[model samples]
Target: MKASLLKEEFKTNKYDEMLKDLYEDASLVDYQKDRYANALDKFIELYGDENVSIYSAAGRSEISGNHTDHQHGCVLAGSINLDAIGVVARQDDVINVVSDSFNIAPIHLNDLDKKDEEEGTSEGLIRGVVSKLKELGYNIGGFKAFITSDVLVGAGLSSSAAFETIIGTIIDGLYNDMSIDMVTIAKVGQYAENVYFGKPCGLMDQCACAVGGLISIDFKDTEHPVVNHVDVDFSKYDHSLCIVDTKGSHADLTDAYGAIPAEMKDVAHYFGKEFLREVDEKEFFDHLADVRDAVKNDREILRAIHFFKENARVPQIVEALNNDDFDLFKKLIKESGNSSYKFLQNVYADFDYKHQAVSAGLALSEIVLGDHGVSRVHGGGFAGTIQAFVENDFVPEYKKEIEKLFGEGSCHVLKVRKLGGCKVVEE
Candidate 1:
């Protein structure tokens, strides 16, 4: 377990053989391969090693539950083929990190275990995690790393969460020797994004991306979320899961995104509370006027209300899926959509594009699939992708119509792979 021994193993592992064996046609998607290649090239250039090992975690599509995660509420989500992958070669005392999509230099691994926000840009997520690992009293050896992500940034697919999860797993498996629990590692990734990277996101994305599979997260106490993995067969079902891009502009929506959690905290303060999740829906609404006046921002109260309703819907949605009740699921999906639009109000800024994407899918699902299923806004919902549970029989026809609106490849069929944070084929 010496650092030098691990470094030697990293350089000698049959990575090509491993990748070829690991990347079954079903194992990795095309974009992931490209990102993995890019990361490998960076590893070769920076660390002078053609033989760096790889660890990967895939991005997720929000199957159910939207803006609710911010309040530490429930979310039903699953992982997709779009993954964030990394290649690591052991380096003595200094771990150099490089990312493919962003033009950032290899970060020093030694300094990383103690990163400062001013010194680190987006890369601070990685440095901060490493730094915290050491503080947690873990044995973390240094390595040169190259990371690449094919998950579309700002697409609501949570690309950053995917990356941070994989990086945390890499540290736990390769450096810390998997001493930290998987959930704890996932939390570290979330902390890296929230505190170090300055992205005001919640734990659902990181947890969903890291945990993989179809699961409902009860963020009633975000620090201790309750998770229940659902067992459902997506392939046997006769329908397609589609994403229709709303094409709603997110420009100038930065503060609107940040304001959600901040205002929720303000709402909590109105009642001398912590998070809006702590309050009941009727209790929250019975005092809507007072809650509205207390927060002073109509939008914040709206966002907080959505959290209550959405968290309540999580169990109902999961039950619909478990019982194969398409009608129930579809109805719930539409209700969730309306809540995001009317209550959460993310759709108000640019209603037209959101309409084009969401309304079109809703209409199409009704027309084409008959009584098959429903569609809803996938994630934060400013304007990106809409998640629809489609009828398997009419999937192609559904994709054809939706693609005409959002371009080809807009709709993707994904399966739940709940392997959790894994490090396979280690050198």
Candidate 2:
């Protein structure tokens, strides 16, 4: 279908069935229509209503295994309903993307080499994904896309990974056969973020955003992560996954985010290894003093401890979910939150007392939910959002209480989406 036809379909009810299938909620029909209409209009305006494809990539929630993936550890993560969508049409060799808020120039695919000037921008991610795809022997071209997202930017939702996966999905749908697996696409996204975007992040975010569902990923081998899609339904237990965006800024926190992997690697280097996963936990304990002296930072040792323990916790949580043990799962979630606060030390940035929104939110959740829910520091920690699992019946009151502190609509009630990165509608 051309952009014009797609717009017409949206105006009518032709896409209602498709939207129901995509969102799984009949109530979201109007919202979906408005979203798709805006994308279609933007596409028509940018490229003059030629035939185009629509793609969507979801943002992810880290269910467990906080700060463990960077050490080549395990994690249980899921793709949320929040996503980044693109309206794209194949171009000759120039990739032009007009995102919602950023003013990024179009990228020419013929010049896909890394440019220091483009680091830390959305253009870097685009170029890096294309470069990685081409290097991996995949067909690469260009497309003009109008991208928009509802994924909260600095709120631990993996928005950057969502955008990268959207680009990868477009490439998969357009040039190459859409047969490229989600894990490969996720790896490409991670490569782009690590090399091009100048963020030394782990594979968990990209994998979760690309794999979808409630998955337990074992990054024992970073190259070939074992992604197990666990069949755990929160609705069955009257629970909802709620993320509270405390509205904290991630600005000037690169050093804080970068220090996690770097500190873990520092401890690993003391053991003559590259990542903490390679070092035996028993051996780390045996040489605690020596390792502490070598790193000269007690916080690094503490972080390494969190890495080992959190890696071990992933399997336990996976088992609980597999056995339909909601109580155990909740218990483990609380434990993960405690570990992140006590050992991981990521509840709030050090020397930043002015912004302790995460800590305050967690404290408030503990008081409000009591024994009915579980809350934790979400995603890359330091500052941003907190993840909470609340009983469905209590959601309205929970949202009200939290919003009073964090402001209205700061709490997002999200579902675990089944699909990851894919072409949503094609003509």
Q: Write down the lDDT of every candidate, Cα atoms only.
A: 0.69, 0.89
lDDT score, candidate 1? 0.69
| CA lDDT, candidate 1, residue 10 | 40
Compared with the true structure, what per-residue lDDT tens digits does model 1 show for residues 1-427? 2223334444554244444433322444443344454555566666665445567787878876777777777888877666767777666665566677464545565566434543337568777677777777877777766677767776788888887787788888777776777667778887887678876677888877887677788877777888778887655556555666656566667776777678878887777777877766677778889988766788787778777887789889999989987677778878988788777776444424544455555555557655655766768766676777777666787788777766788777555555556675465
* Ten residues in sequence with the least summed lDDT for candidate 2: 19-28
lDDT of candidate 2 over 1-427, digit per residue (tens): 7998888888799989887766655778889889989889988877798888899999999999998887889999999888899988888888989998565788887888888987899989999999999999999998888999998888889999999999999999998779899999999999999888988778888988898888999988988999999987756878889999998888888888888888999999988999998999999999999998888999999999999999999999999988999999999999999999999899888968778999999999999998778899998887789999999889898999999999999999987778889889874
Clashing pairs in 2: 1-427
The regions of model 1 sitting more than 4 angstroms off are 1-51, 101-103, 113-120, 289-304, 324-327, 350-370
Candidate 2 ranges with C-alpha deviation above 4 Å: 101-103, 289-296
